[model samples]
Target: MGGYDGLVVLVGVALLLTTGRCDTSCGGTDGSPGVAGTPGRDGRAGMKGEKGEPAVKAEGPVDEVVLLTLKGEMGNRGLQGVMGPKGYRGDLGATGRPGQPGRPGPDGKNIGHGQQSAQQGHSAFSAIRTDNSLPRYEQRVTYQTIVVNKPGDFDKNTGYFTCRVPGVYYFSFHSMSKVSMCLRIASDALNEKLGFCDYNRNNDQVLSGGVVLQLTARQKVWLESFRDQQPSTDQRDTRDKYIIFNGFLLFSNDPELHFSLCGTGRGGFYFPVCSVRLPIMLHHFVLVIGALLSFAVPVKVAMESCPAAAMPGIPGMPGLPGRDGRDGEKGQKGDPGAAWAGGLGPQKGEKGEPGLMGFPGKRGQSGEPGRSGEPGLSGPPGEAGEPGTVGTQDRAAFSVARGTNEYPEKASVIRFTKVITNINNDYNTETGRFRCRVPGTYYFVFHASLEDRLCVVLKLDQTLLTSFCDHRRGRRQVTSGGLAVHLSQDQEVWLETKDYIGMRGKPTGFSIFSGFLLHPH
Candidate 1:
């Protein structure tokens, strides 16, 4: 069967080749195609054949120009090619235009519904004591120097600041004294103390204190000495200012309210709008009564209108509306209308009671969120806070000197009795020793006038810390020594003479002893 099929294919190819050659050589015309033929039955399926060999290459005529062309079926797509190498980075693009403005935020709720009614009040005063004479015990300290007295509330002669406006006020005082003094800031109206300062020394020292007070109208504030203590005068410079007192209002609690007229008229005054809506008979009666009272009682007209120099006040609030009138009697019903139009209407009935509330409807689907709004403007800054109180720690210091020159006293402590500056009272005038209250490092120094051989030793709790000596023959000489030592609480430190002593003190020699805390533990 294979041989027979191969023979038929070879014969068909040979006949097609011969016919094409003959037609080209003899130039014969094409014959008509035959159509009438009986149909044949379908043949059986054949076995699958092996792969065929590729066709050999054939060379055509060099210059054979073919005019007619036939369309061919499209071939299957080829496999994808290899990927290309990575490309170089591209140049940056130009910047885009600015975006549109953002949506505006919602309006804020109003705080106060009307215009402001009052302004900030201001009242401040500062005075200094000028008289050097001592006052009687518990007397008020008077001031001859008036630095500033805004609103003229402070009376210099009486040394008292009388309150005219009710508000919070701050008061402070500074005094320089050479004697033990107790000064206090007191309210005269209440006869109560507000603040005080205790300064005890025999030399010049400054003491200061301050306090804040909430005061009412008619209250008075002044400075007074306690236990007959006197703030001594500054002997060196009489012109130097001392004993200064200051007071100022921080804020007010009351707002001023007054009536104002709207038109320029001599007899016009402020009155509510509802008062002018009276009936004709009532108006006549009020006019007669006003005329009768005109002669006996004076009618002070506190009228205000457009001013030439100052801004006007805000107008008063409006009055309430009048009441409704009574209803009239009902009328008869009307006749019916034509058929093409609407029929007769029903009469209006009285209002009925409200029905029960219905169930809530279903929630709707959520919408896309809106864009964010722009930021709001910043608010004004807040007010400053009040002054802080004074600290009491880390304030240990002293300065003492001897008043009388004394002779030798072996194995004994040299006591300097006169006090100049004993801030925390760490030094003892009777014991001639310094007791530590706060544990810390301290610096101590002393200067002694010697007429003959003298030796002084600094001791800490019976342990020698340092010493100094001076020798001269019947002639005055000076000796000084100092040291920085660490001390603990309850430790005792003092200066003592050993073997020989010639310590001169006070007015003639001016010997002194001083010490101060350097750092706290």
Candidate 2:
């Protein structure tokens, strides 16, 4: 069919074919596009399609969010997004720059002050500040000082004052005769009477003596006066006239209207200042001068300057005695006595044994003529004698008889009690004891002496010893004719030095050489 010629035919065929699409094509098919089946009527349109979730939108560096309301109809839900992977960390920020600096503040200048000025010599802390018109306050002594005297009255014009440190005090007081001046000091926080300077000089003189007082820091002290006797003069006027103290000075730093409740009666300065100020180093000089002056009071003790003395020479009498003439030479010693010079005698033993007759003494130079004997020739030497035997000793042995043969028996000196008789020695004091063999009175003498402090004291037990310094040197002394000592039986007499003494020769011994029993009474 070429275009127009088949057009109608094709159209017819298409319609027929379309009409027959539901019919089965072959044998036994369950479902197919065959003409046998017819189309069911269109079911109600399927429910409208579910809507999707709107996409989230984002802008630049910052994030944006939106909110939406849900519709009343049901819808299919969208899937959730997966979580993102972790991101890398960012770097730390840089440190900041430092800030700037700031500006500076006033000048200080010193004004006027004092108390530290005279620390070198001839100086001490002045009582008043340098600004004479002003008083001291709030300030204290920068250095330590000594107070010469207390500056307080009996709490009259001054505030109560306390001592600050302990030291010696020098004080002065002046008053007339028959009046009493008393000084009062407070310690342990109470006023106490310290000392009294009673002026009892009806002769218009002053009496002064020292009293020591001890004080400590912040201790209160005061001075006062009293009239002891009933004087004809007014006591109050006399108290005002007195000024008797000078020891040490204590002070307070800052001065105000306040003062030690003190007064000096009705007077000039409570404690006047001597105008001269000295360097502190010169303080020793002041002390020396003050000490000198203090010691020089009462006229008798005044110092007298004088020249020095020469050294002393050896002590001796001024002139020498006449010299003695020299003597002749001494003779030589004589030979020993010849053996058996005299008639032979019997041998002797010790005192216990019968003593042998003493060998006959050398022959006396007598005039007796001897009968002549026949002349003989010389004889040969005799045989050597045998050694003599040793002798035994005895206890309580008596000494050989003593003989004073130096001088004639009549010329030898003798003592009854001591070696020196009172006639020969002065100051020789001696005591004697005697046993009465004949019961008769005896004549006795004393020999006592003190050879330049070598004193001799004599005493006897069972007897009254009487002695005194006769002061007569070198003599035999007898008991005073007026008083005498009588003794009987046995008595022990001894001598001793009255003081620490040395001896000259022997000071004591006794001998009866011619001490005769007599009727001395």
Candidate 3:
């Protein structure tokens, strides 16, 4: 058949097959439908056609069949069309609000209170009692009674107060005696008397002494009658004050509160803020505030506002003049002047007769020795002298020999008591050790004579430098070992036996440990 007739026949057969399979009327229930396929991607847009030639003016109406026939099959996909013009940039996104602030962290630990309580219990105490009891001179005066003991720092039995803290402390002592007496305040910590009070009258009198000092922990202070003072026999009521000794801590040496509250030039007191009691600080603070307020107001205005000042009063008689002060000490005598020479204007008279010799004046005491003067500047070094005959170099050298030929115990260090030659005294005969005075290379030798097995070791400081062992038993066995070692200054070396070694009863000086410095580094 012709090509066109064959195609037409196939088309007719396909139509008939499709028509026969289609069922218009409903019959049995339909089977479940298969899942729909995914939609296909849309085809890319076609390239724009050239501007149409001026629209043709057509008198007849356009025909749809002609337009449909004009459409052509799609050509091979053209190169990807140019990307569409970029779209207008969108408005910038609104900035996000700042995140909320994080919650505050927990508070730090409290340090002020802990520092303030470090020296909370520091205090001083003292008292005096009178009941016909007298203490011997040069002895500690016990009050036998206490009036105030804030911290119990003083011991009534010992009549002494041991400082409990390292800080400044104030001590005071008072005594009442019927007869003339002297009292002394002494401190073992200072190894001397701090102060003394003396009453020179036979009638009853009071003597007191006080001292402020920086004391260290465990330091002791006390009051005692002066040596050789007469004992008092006067009887007095118990209520009468006689003797007392007391001291108290001013402040501690806590570093946390170290600061000067006032200037030392004005006799100011200084204390650690942490060591001061709260009550004392508050009291001081109140005083400071009151002082500031008082200074801020006008004194004259306040005085005028007072009722007493507003009412005038009659003037009183003047007070008598004060007595004149005692005379000052006499001045020292001046040395005699040399005789003047006669002037040329007039001739001098004959010299007077020699005056009678006055009794020899008492020999004046020798003057105290003068203090040593500072050292003078060093003189320039002298020129080198001519060279002399060359001699052996004086290298540090030492040799030791056994004093007694006796067997050494097992595991004991062998001591060389007899030093044959110690040029530099580097070897200690008592310790049997050689200490290196100069850093250098050294040669050490150990010679041992034994009849039985023995092991010897040479140790430098704590390390073994060399060792020797001999197991043979001979009538006269000799074992020798040596080592060349580098030693640092102050390093020590010695020889020790690992096992028992036999020795001749006679002093042969065969066994020896010796070392010599080869060259200083």
Candidate 4:
């Protein structure tokens, strides 16, 4: 290899003449041109000790010096290098998410529509035009225009006709307004309103139109006088022209019609400007079929009409709408979804849902206590039942018990005296109650006691069975059919009670004998 490249160029010029390091690159010289490198550190450390020294090959020139470099400047922008290592971690950033909500749009066609406008009746018929704002006048012209809103300007100049015959109608309009004989209208036909005016002023201002009443079976509509004609800078009478109409008449109001007006004046002119033809009032068509309500849909008459070019209200509210800004931080709770254990891999979202008992679960053990009751028998002696009423007020005025009763009626009246009377004497009373009506066996006798010691037997239901009768062989007259006693279909065994102290000298028989019986003993 040519002596191993001339002994590696004289051992790199003897190690650059012994390390005087001439700006390194000690290889391709010839002044300056790039791409030719590698030869320093003393030409590779003295070519490892001159391998064979008999090689020279590197003529003159050993010192080097040229250091003012200038190569396209774009460097030192570093420090930006560390970011490169982060590349492999990219996939995890895709969570900038939430873009998946855009697919729900086609359900909009509710497309509902309906519109009708012919405001009120008559709408138009003509004499020269006059609109009497109401009574029964309703000028609905979806075929032209006249509704000036209120009687303020009176039907604006109502006039139209093109219906064969249905019946009932009267309408008008005799507008004068600084006149140009105006009346522009069009909802679809009679295309007229080109313009004009001149209604000579002097306050005679005679222009009237209105009658509307009864119009059935309608017939489209058509007519025009758009009245116009004074277009020469009209100020009314700017060279007055004559009359061209007077045979027109239409009205509806008739609030008991009594209306009438008259006019006359021709100083240099033509005549015949009074006209009429209008109707829609049998009560304004019954107030338009009583305002057809069922949530109203009459829409005046529905459109295929009102379109003179319909344009009145919606084009973005005209003004005011813009204030909102200052709300930014409540967004942190979202990251727990991707199975959150460091990211993207779904598998742990299931523990939460147990709350809905505002109140209902404590009545399950009260249905099992129904089984302990069966031991009872032994009863057969009961009869004495009835008596119950006669209650007009004798609880003790006289006495009565056994199922309760003792009605010596006359309610609060017991003023019957006889025996020196006066014991609780609200007055004295003694119709002597010994009432014992039939159930046999009774002798509660009161023989006006005071007799030489008598028999005493009082009973108000102890059945005085004085140990089953015989009340102990009293002074005599003590009776009790005893044991044959059966009483219960309203049963009562009675006699006087209380003040009944008949033991010693037994003279206590208070007497009322007629009310007692029972000697069949």
Candidate 5:
């Protein structure tokens, strides 16, 4: 093998060293010499050569320089081979650091001014009869006049003050009459009279009553005299301020009570000054005195019992123990106490028989359900059942599309012409009705493309189940509604449009109605 390899290497080197000379072929213009050369016979073939021995493997690694030289002397590139399989994905990169915070924006406009305006609108009004010169004397007189109307809540023409804000208010009315009469203040909104005042005298006397009432917005109040009693028609226009009606807001019904300086100090105090308007009754006086005593008594007792500072006394030494006292004789027992001396003592009675058991009480209502528990571990699957015969397909499903894109003129059933999937043939394409073939729970959905305004309702028989409505301003809009219903066999369901006008038809098949049986009963 070694000798053969060496011979082959020498032959390769000789071939590389030798250079071939160029040869030129002459054209045979003349016929004589060209014809003689053409008759030469073909050369004989050489014998077959024996197979060469296999090359021996190298013992050690090749030198770096020789390996590089061999790599540089590579032959012409071969055709590209088929692509290799994709490699596995690399690990995800680390997360980047957070960015710095941005600068704050400019200050916004103040919104408290609007809130203050809303609060200022919540005020009260007061009014009185301005015309006392009229000679007509009648009972049940609605004071149709105004003397002091604040915030303009009270109407002089209607004799009613409509509450603009819900809050607690104080109302007062005073009237003078020459004869006995009953003055009443009432509220039609409350459907009851609030307060009453009476003046029973031949001479002119004053009658006044006040009420602290909680009223809501739009509620009305008025002053009226009782129809059973007649009020004196004294025409004397004295400056007695006799007939007067007044009211003021106490506090609004806001969740958080807010007090303004004017509202808090109207009568010169941080607290509500009820004495300025509301008459203090005996109970109110007692409450005030009790509150004052409650504070003053504790302070007085604390001051009286306060210990005075004094110098500490010298430490005393321990004294010797005294002798024990002698034992005293026992006293005789007291006489037996009379029966029922302090109070009547009942005699012991005979034992009673056991009573029968009572019937059990009705069960209380069930409490709210508790949260669902975590799922348990799954069990092994059951064995497979025997193969059964293939059953016929009886799917109850339908998909319908409206024939026209135009909106219905009025509320009416929408008929469908295009049927996409109507298995079991349970849907009527002409009337757009679907009859339930299987008694089971099913899901139904309807979609409509609205251009202007449209309202569509999904109905089960004649009963409306669900509705969808939309009003588009510029372009057509699409709205859909769906419901899950437990339907019996032969139950009908359809879609009805309400007040749908100028609705563009869905040529792109956007509007659709579909239903399917979830599971047959």
Candidate 6:
């Protein structure tokens, strides 16, 4: 093994020594370097060579120059090494530009609400009478100035509202007259009158009345005067200032029921037959389709082979038997019945003897009870009764308004001077307190208008019952508070500012303090 190792080392040195022969030998410059050849295929690994003996140590000194010269140009890079470990994930990529917007979708269909709105069933009418002519007895008051009459149900010429839809309606009227006036709201559907309004004051008088009625289609309603002196209208005052009639449908009972008066104004009564209305859109669509069909098929042939009218519906069930009819008039006598069957052809039979009278016959079970008797006449007035005991007159009530704005000291009672009402003089304006006259529960309320902050407390004899506060920046504010408290006789209650005093008063009574006795214990 030592000899073989030495032989291999000497052979490698000889190759190295011959590699510089071009530099040492006298040879012309070398030709251009040859092109790189394609790499050779790797040979299969051979069996493991036997381990050489331990390297022998050389005895002479090793030259560093020889070692340096033995090194050759780096061999071609070894076959690509196995793939390295996966690197750390790279930073997130930049955001991409937005794409062009997609085309708009087709137009959407109109969707109707499943539930109908409350405003859809609107039916209202308003009118004013400006004519000075007085209507005759039992005549309708004509309102020529028609303010609003939706659906054209009101007849200004006849002064009657003929119903077009069945629903509950509210009717109201206001009349101003100096002379006596009496009006009646009448409906043809009902036997009794709806409402009445009477004003008999010699001075200017106003009267108003309202009524709610359930009306059916084709029913006529109007305001009429049955008395001799009807409500006089003013020709000067128009513009709905007086003698105005208004009516509106509150809610509908049936939305689809419609009627058409047939054979009206005949010798007999008029009958209104019900009808159903189809959608206008549906009718238009059906007409279009029919026109197209008529064009597609020759009109001459279509008309020649026209279909027969639809067969009538099956007859309804038979009704119940009618009531018995009245008797017919008697016929004329028939020649005296042929002289009583040959007159006296046969002789009269012998007269029979009279039978004996029977007893009373036990009263015949008293027959059926007689009907109730008519009401008796009212009796004369009775004598006057004795005088009764007097009621407790212990009452307390007051309503006062402030006349000016006040910014009182802290914890001061608010003085209300302008007294609107003071029952039994229980509220003292000087002290700004209501001294209870009767021991009972009393309710007190106060309203204050302010431009700044305000905190008020309702005090019952120095004990606060409740507090109210209103704070706003720019606009005026109003605050109201109420409380019911039980008070003994002479106990006082009043309104006062708690910490901040802010209040404004007006002649219109914007600030008010009122208290009333609910009951006396």
Q: After superposition, how far is residue 258 of candidate 2 from its true place, in Å?
A: 32
Give lDDT tens digits, candidate 1, residues 1-521.
99999999999999999877755554324444444334444444444444333222233222212212322334445445444444444444444444555455444321111322112345789998865544444788888888999878899899889987665566667776554444566784333453233333355655554444557777998887665223444223343335888987644444333345443223333444432455565434444343444456778986344232434334444444434433333433433221221322222234444544445444444544444545544544434432222134555666676767777378899888877546568899899999998788987877665667888899999999988886653644345677998999989899999977888763434466777766779
- Descending-TM-score candidate ranking: 1, 6, 3, 5, 2, 4
Quote the lDDT for 490 in model 3.
91
Q: Between the candidate structures 1 and 3, which one is better when assessed by lDDT?
A: 1
Clashing pairs in 5: 405-505
lDDT of candidate 6 at residue 166, scale 0 to 100: 61
Report the lDDT tens digits of candidate 6 across residue range 1-521: 99999999999999888766634553433344444445444444445555333212233333335434544444444444445455455454444445445455444321113322222445789999876554455788887799999868898889899876565566667777655455666787555553333334345555554445667778988987655333344223333224788887644453332224643323322356556788665333333333434345555533233223333444455455444444444444333111223222223334445444433333223334445445445544444432221133544566676767566557888888877557567889999999988898887776665556788898887887889887653434445677889999889999888777777765221466777766678
Worst 10 contiguous positions by lDDT, candidate 4 = 395-404
Taken over the whole model, the C-alpha lDDT of each candidate is 0.61, 0.29, 0.57, 0.28, 0.55, 0.61
- Predicted structure with the largest TM-score when compared to the true one: 1
TM-score against truth, every candidate = 0.29, 0.18, 0.27, 0.13, 0.26, 0.28
Counted clashes in each candidate structure: 0, 73, 0, 68, 1, 0
Model 6 segments more than 4 A misplaced: 1-51, 58-121, 131-133, 165-168, 188-192, 199-202, 214-217, 228-242, 249-521
Worst 10 residues of 2 by lDDT: 393-402
Write candidate 4's Cα lDDT for 1-521 as tens digits. 99999999999999887555433423332332334333333212212222222212234221212112313334333232222222222222223323334344443221111211121222322232233221111233222233332212122234334332232222222344333333221222212111112233333222222111233333333223432233444432433222211111122222111223433224422245566879766543334344554675565654332322334443333233334434444333322211223332223334445433344333333334434444334444445432222121221111111111122222222111332211122212343333322234422212221212223333444455432122222222212221234332234433333322221111111122222222322
Ranking the candidates on lDDT from highest down gives: 1, 6, 3, 5, 2, 4
lDDT by residue (tens digit), candidate 2, 1-521: 37886898989999889656524332232332323334334444444444433322232121112122322333334343344344343343343333332222122211113212111101111121111111112112111122322333222223223443333222222233333332232234333332332333233333332222334445654334333332434343332222333333211122211223444222222433335667665334334343434454555564343223323444443344334434434434444322332333112222243334444444434344434444444444444433221111100000010122121122121122322112112111222223333333433322221122223334445333543333332321111111223434343333333432322212111011112223322
Tens digits of lDDT, candidate 5, 1-521 = 99999999999887765522111222223322222222224334434444333222233322335323432233345445444444444444444444444444443321122332223445756666645442233233445456666568877666677887665565656676554434555674443453233333355555555444557778877766553333444334333334577776644454333454444543322444353567776653333333434344444433232123334444444444444444444444444322333333323334444444444444444444444444444444444432221121334666555667666657777876766446557889867788988787877776554556677788998999988776644433345677989888789998887876544444432356777765567
lDDT score for candidate 4 against the true structure? 0.28
TM-score of 5: 0.26
Runs with alpha carbons beyond 4 Å of true place in candidate 1: 1-118, 188-191, 195-197, 228-241, 256-274, 278-521
> What would the per-residue lDDT of candidate 3 be over residues 26-47, giving only the tens digit for each residue?
1333344444445545545445
Error of 1 at 303 (Å): 99
Give the per-residue Cα lDDT of candidate 1 at 155.
94
